[model samples]
Target: MTREPTVAEQSHPNYVKVWGVLVALLAVSVVGPMFEIKLVTLVTAFGVAILKAYLVARNFMHLHIERRYVTYLLVGMVALMLLLFAGVAPDVMKHEGHQWKNEAAQKVVRDAAPAAKVH
Candidate 1:
């Protein structure tokens, strides 16, 4: 015998609605870059991405119905990602002429080498 869906499951929004919302968010992200304003386009794209992520996690992954600990874990994961990016940002932003120094050293070495005697 087939079992009926629980009341909680029935109370959730229909899958089609969730899918439609995801599709709309995706469209927004895709169209956002067409704007000439760089900041506005970036914000719009990231905003849509966050919204789509939330919808997928809550509805498709059933995180909304899960316990509080699961939500906390998700939040922690996001925090960890932010921390990692923060740690890497400074290194990415700073450059101390290392490339130029390497090129200068190479040129000096090439100049010191004796010319080969060709037959």
Candidate 2:
């Protein structure tokens, strides 16, 4: 014996459509670099990635049917990630003086000099 799909199942968005949208978003991400605009390409790739993530989460992970608390948790996680990135951004962007090269050159000169002969 076989069972028919329920009304809820019938009302859900078609899996094929969702998969096609994901593929289209992936294509956008792949082709975004061809434009030769760094900011635009980055934004396009990230946007497509976010969209694809949403689609997968909603359809495959069934987040669309999840409770409000789950949504809140996801939002909180995203906020925390942004906060962490902001906290680290300044240190990551800082360009400290290039002391390594000077140290390397000095070490080379020091090593090149002949060692004194021990009696």
**Local accuracy of candidate 2 as per-residue lDDT tens digits, 81-113:** 999999987555543345524456556566767
Error of 1 at 15 (Å): 0.9
What pairs collide in candidate 1? none
Worst 10 residues of 1 by lDDT: 93-102
Any runs in candidate 1 off by more than 4 Å, and if so which? 1-10, 96-119
The C-alpha local distance difference test score for the whole of candidate 1 amounts to: 0.77
Please, what is the whole-model Cα lDDT of each candidate in the order they appear? Answer: 0.77, 0.76
Root-mean-square deviation of candidate 1: 10.5
Residue lDDT tens for model 1, 25-68? 88888888888689878877997888888888878777877777
Backbone N/Cα/C clashes per model: 0, 0
Which parts of model 2 have CA positions greater than 4 angstroms off? Answer: 1-11, 96-119
lDDT of 2 at 66: 69
Root-mean-square deviation of every model: 10.5, 11.3
Most accurate candidate by TM-score? 1
**Residue pairs that clash (backbone atoms under 3 angstroms), model 2:** none
